[model samples]
Target: MIVRTIRADDYPGLNRLHASVGWPQRSPDGWRWLADNPARREIGAPEGWVLVDAADRPCAMLGNLIQRFVLDGRSLYGATGFSIIVPPQHKGASRPLIQAFLDQPGVFAHYTLNANARSASLYGRLGLRPWPEQTHALKLSWTIDPLACLHGRLLRRAYGRVSAEAAETMGERLMNRRLWRPGPLRLPHGVVDIRDVSDSSPYGRFWGTLSEQGALIADRGAEMMRWRLADPDLPRRPLLLGRVEDGRLTGTALAMTAKTSIIDPPSLEIIDLQGLPGFDAIPLLARTLIRNARGLGAAKVRLQALTPDLLSRLGDLARSARREGGWGHGHAAFSDEAVAASWSPTPLDGDYLMCNRPVPPAAERQWARRRAQASRASKA
Candidate 1:
């Protein structure tokens, strides 16, 4: 078998490999997005590396996303592995694919989120040290009935209709709970207004301002926002909220409905949150997300606070919104000690924000049409 960087033409084979492992198949738009992404070229490789047999059939693939940041007064690089697939026949391909990723230069660190025990052991042997601090800081919103949630999970595993109804009911109850609801939209005396904005709005400005005041954060400027938020295959459009005072954007937050394997009901994930020095806008932002999530029928709101300061502030905000602290983990590995020490990663840093959901028949047809149009355009 030969291991090599994946190219656009390899997506069909990759999709087949993904299916063989029971992973969600990528939409045609997803494959196109991967092909067109500039980061692929920036990393001097495609979205991943694939191992192919003598007949040129792909047997394994490791996918990643490269994110650049300024850490400790210098430019730093990181890549997060999003997917690794190897079938029983291709078991031998895993090591070589991982080794090729490790050999890539210029990346100061490699990160993975929510790795299973077996994968963790393999990564540990390959020099990836787990950063537990990042893993321990997740905050959860809304109260859930554990038994109901469990029933939903079991039903879903068996592909039962009751699962959908149960999940929806659980979501509605979680949102309708008085504890999860903030009485009204109330801003402090200085805060002039709170409202929704487009993801491509001036929120990037607020992100930049906060980056200057806080620790090193992944680049989430206009370009990154467009690339990440505008994916057509995304199950839900990100909700963007902003706080303004005297016509200046003081704070911003972005949330999306996401499905997780471990969680029975879908969740509203807070992927990005930025506020001015006092963190005055966080509580309001949290309230708005909870309210909107209720409309989206999401069971909970999830937040990741990477730094101690953000963690404390978010914890307080969650408490104000009557949210509970739950056990969730985020993991990272670094090549440079200093960069790793200063680095702060949010759920938005990598492909973690992209959650797979079952597509409705109508949506699937729409995607099929779009795929045909894209193929025609490409051939032209």
Candidate 2:
């Protein structure tokens, strides 16, 4: 039973393990990005960890170390997409393998991962606790339909003008905004390209940078957003993307509707919202989203507070009610990881105040059941 750092060459085997466990396939480019990501090397968990049985077969693996967290002005590390993919015969190997995985130096520092309640318990054993928080998906209620709201022709023209140079610059600017201080961005009306439209655009790039840089971290990103947009299994959840103007994508939103209960009005989740320098557009972006929600017959929209800005600005939108705070314990060789730290969490007193909403107990229980099921299934 050996637990060790996976090398770059192990990617294919890791990919195979993830696929065999009902996970999606990964492209070479994406996998390479994960392998070479700066955060992993800085924290000393570069390849995350792969557990091999005595014979040295790669029985299980966790994909990437996706987040860097800043708590009280210091940074912490968290793993996103961490998994153990032991074959059915080796299912029972997970417990010890996970224990060994965590024993790896720097493995637990500021690491945050979202699991069902049961997994949370496993984390507890490892000194990782649930950050008392509830994530909400907000669907804005808009007075207009999505089709009517589009200035499509204008956007197409705008996307056309976006050169790779512009893309790179906007991308870099957004990266700066997330990692450094926030300020107004001055942009000529024509230079931005909001076309890729989802978080993969400047905004998604910001969140990814945030996680990778140690500001804020999450368990998922671009791939999940891309997948959600095309997810066929979840029939109730329809996908939509919007840009403030053609190239300047100010916001991105996603919604999931339930099939069991029409009376169980569809719920919309604002997966990620990124506002450009002119912050005024953020409110408008919020409003447009709500209008879209109303069109879909959603009961109420849910939104997660990625940073303090959303909580502060939308804190008073008439329908904007406070949701519960999500909390977690993260640790990292803060000093060692600082060099690679690209971002930090917004000050607690800043516009980053997160509100907590009630998480239905039943929902929590259901989620726990599902997580336990996933854990058990993985073991099987």
Candidate 3:
């Protein structure tokens, strides 16, 4: 088998392989993003590799992304998405693709992938130790709750009532089509008022701002967000914008209509969920969403969450697969189920502050001490 970097001409083959293997293959927008991405050349197809049989046939392929993030006051990089397209039975061809990934020096301190136990064993054999990680899924079989459906209707009416013109303009600008309604639901305790992704005030601005920070790793700007959120291919995907009374975006959730393996009916899966510091609304959100999905005549609501908070909160819902973080600009799949099911803590060298290990306890204490001193000095 020939394991090597993928070329520009190799996209079709790679795409085909991913499709055959039942992976969430790239879309046209993703393809465009990859082609024009500055990281394409650096990490080899955005830290991806392709393997070919001696006949030069594309036998197996995998892609990895390295991302930089701050965790526990330290900078770290995480390597993720070690996607393999070759069937598990093709042991010879598959080994090289993963081997090529590990061969890179200092390329990853930790690594992750969305593989089941069988595939995970291969990673363990290759020196990629497993961390406690998870992915979650929700089966949308329950009928939509009448009350929740009414609430969504009321939210939409309230939004429209705010100004038919504003609603119309936003619909055109954001292409929002979720059946939302303004409500006075007796929300549970700590159930903060979740702002609609369409809320035009501080919520929208906050989202744009946070997205900008996330985009800095890449060279793109507003155009990137537009491309990501408004990709024509991702229709019926609700982009939620929410905030608390303190004007902080407490929770940002997005749901997209899609099919699932667990259920036969259509369902809306949460692609992403972002909450403010110390606020974990995923379980509540998941429960609410499940109720809502039943109300929507769907079977389930699935969410992919990888944050530390959700990982701990919904640990029980975790699947057997392991998911590593990846670098590059792509759609953020934030869902409670996905988070619960497939979150791995493999650290790429550049993605997290403590990518290699949970920040050593001593280091964390020292950092905390210094931070406290700095705060005291500022007050003095």
Candidates 2 and 3 compared: the better one by lDDT is 3
- Lowest summed lDDT across 10 adjacent residues in model 3 is found at 352-361
Taking all chains together, the TM-score of candidate 2 against the true structure is: 0.46
Q: Which candidate number would show the highest TM-score if scored against the true structure?
A: 1
- lDDT ranking of the models: 1, 3, 2
lDDT of 1 by residue, 259-375 (tens): 453224656677777677764676667666765554555556666434555565566554554333343334556676765665555566756665334222233344456668879
TM-score of each: 0.74, 0.46, 0.54
Q: What shift in Å separates residue 285 of candidate 1 from its native position after superposition? A: 1.7
**Which stretches in model 2 have alpha-carbon errors above 4 Å?**
41-44, 66-81, 84-109, 132-271, 274-283, 286-312, 316-380
What lDDT tens digits, residue by residue, belong to model 2 across residues 308-378?
A: 44555554562454443233322222334444243222111111111111122233344456668879999
- Report lDDT per candidate: 0.61, 0.42, 0.43
Tell me how candidate 1 scores on lDDT: 0.61
